[model samples]
Target chain A: MHGKRVGQWNGERTYLLCVHCHNPHSPRFKPIKPLPPPQRPSEMKR
Target chain B: MSQDPPCTGACSGETAPDPSRRTVVQFLAAGAAVASTGCSLESFFRKSFRELSPAQVRRYIAELEGRYGRKYGKTVTVGTAGPMEGVKFGYGLDLSRCVGCRRCVYACAEENNQSRKNPQIHWIRVLEMDKARGVDVNHSDIYYDAAEVPRPGHFYMPVQCQQCDDPPCVKTCPVGATWKEKDGIVAIDYDWCIGCRCCMAACPTEPGTSTGPSRTSPPPK
Candidate 1:
């Protein structure tokens, strides 16, 4: 892979992976839970 | 409280005969012991940034670096650099230009040393919104993890801290631990922050907003 390479196919569109883009071993993003809402200061006791 | 000198072991000299004074001293000693076990005793009662002398601030930062370094098993430097004189910091994203690749998301997390384990913290979160709906963020999908992005008629919007002119987060902090700087950046004093997360809730942007795992089932073809 000199500078650009065709990565795995995904549906209809094709994506180009630049030499600087991602690690070949683990390219997918990890899902994160949204930060939880804050409770009232009084609720902290519970 | 300001008038009283910080309690020391030998501070009970003349007050030794008073029963109430003895009780108060005993209570303070117990509180100190608990705080010392939590973190450095000095840090627990550290003064606000405005109250600290320059030397005190430097020593405080050094102590933080040492403690965090030991915890993470690597040396880390905590900087107290202030913002530029007149420059204000703001973020702008061009929906037309973004491809929803999520490179920015990962880069921010790694750079900030956010936990990659449970309850990860990602400062930037990109949402895939329907172009037909214009800029309706309430309907935007943040958990969209298609194998490829720039999907069909959807537009991308990257959301982070907006640092509003009248930031609700700053107002919501019970203690004055969080504040907006002159340059329009909202900052939290971690040392003083009770971790109440009122600011997190007050922010217009959703918390824990980050690129998430791919859907288990494939999208309908």
Candidate 2:
């Protein structure tokens, strides 16, 4: 559904997702991260 | 790190899964089904962003309903609004000029009216990150140790809730305990809180404190 909380605990990564710009829910119904930059194949195949 | 395992359904995979494929085939079938309905699914169980066409979104949502099934179809928690509403709090910290002082953390304790037996829980915290190559990743919570200010060479980053436009904690709250307000601040209904901790996990704020009651912490001077 919604992107899992922005910073989820990836035990392997050993870092927490800081809640700087995210709330668990929103009043305005905004997506946490802006919709991905319009996808470009050049960017995709780095 | 290598991403976690694929979610295996409406959470990922937009193309027809190859039945002939041997390696990721098992996950692909489930993914194809989800993609058919169209929803954002991460390559891993993560809940990553996926662009879904309208038909895909409708289908994905329906499938999610099916997967979670009857568990979510009915009310599992409290819905009655409490007097806790009409209350709001906001936190701001300017990282570009922070000095790694813990005074704000303590000040938050006194200002927010927190319990004194332990550390006063403030929604704000200052962290130190190494400016050296690849060292920002090793940042530490200075509050865990409560040290002196202006630790020589490290860069200071004081973090507080950005009061995000969208909040994941409120969405996943099974009890509807948390809600973002018109002011962009997210307030929790303490009376209705089920303490499921879903909100804490959903918050992206640093040291996203979970103690009962809350307050806005002052910034470092």
Candidate 3:
């Protein structure tokens, strides 16, 4: 609708599939352990 | 007292050029040329992807393949494929099926070869929000940690490049490093990026795009 295609239509293809990115069982993204923050300039050794 | 003073080189038309100064100038000029020869001036003067001709694109791809091959000690192929005619990409997600597991987050990072360490870069961000609020961004939490997904009444929403028809990121880019492609994909030319973070500021979705230190050499063993 309004130049935007909604719901998969015939003669159209998705660049990527949902299963390619999301698993059917657990579609939610898992929590990630963030990397350590960068060191402060004052904390650096000369 | 009435006699004229010695010329002392002041009354002379022009002073003799200093041989040492001339030699230094020549040496500097030669040194600069030599230094620049080692660096690829072709890359510095290379035009943007949209501006490059077919022949130039091929040459650029070859140069990239050679550079990456040398760096990785393996044959590397740099694809120069253009968008397909009459084909545009659209992405959709089913919120009802989403469980809030961040598998896509890691998948995207690995697929894009994002930097893993030092300055860790993730293009997609999954935010946890309360169901009652109904997509209130101010109340959403990106750092939510839970033992099991679909926690109580919380819902997950993953955000990334919207690939807007009129992208604000592209508009705010002072150097035109990022642009919207014909396939409805937003592309960033890393070489043209100046790390000014102007695009980041212009993006409505915070953390839509990420910037970090580029990995130049092979990671430490």
Top lDDT prediction, candidate number: 3
Instruction: Note the Cα lDDT for every prediction shown.
Output: 0.66, 0.54, 0.68
What TM-score does each prediction get for chain A alone?
0.23, 0.17, 0.43
- TM per candidate: 0.53, 0.42, 0.58
Candidate 2 lDDT for residue B119 = 27
Q: DockQ for all models, in order?
A: 0.04, 0.02, 0.08
Residue B209 in model 2: lDDT: 55
Model 3: clashing residue pairs? A28-B99, A28-B100, A28-B101, A29-B100, A29-B101, A29-B102, A30-B101, A30-B102
Q: In candidate 1, what are the lDDT values of residues B1-221, reduced to their tens digit? A: 11233555665465543556756876697677767678664554564124766767787888899999999999999989877686787766556557677777777766666544444456777888898998898998776767666677888787888878888988999999878889888777676677777777778886543323322323434
Model 3, runs deviating above 4 Å = A1-46, B1-81, B215-221
Per-residue CA lDDT of model 3 for B1-221, tens digit only, reads 12222333533686645656655665676567756777544553453124756666677788899999999999999887767787877666677656667777777767777755444556777778899999998998766766667677988888887777888999999988999888888889877888899988999887744565545323544
Scored against the true structure, residue B190 in model 2 reaches a CA lDDT of: 73
Docking class of 2: incorrect
Best TM-score among the predictions, by candidate number:
3
Model 1 lDDT per residue over A18-45, tens place: 4356674586444334332222234333
Tens digits of per-residue lDDT for model 2, B125-221: 6666665632353555443332444444566676666676788887989988788887567777775676677777876664445646433334434
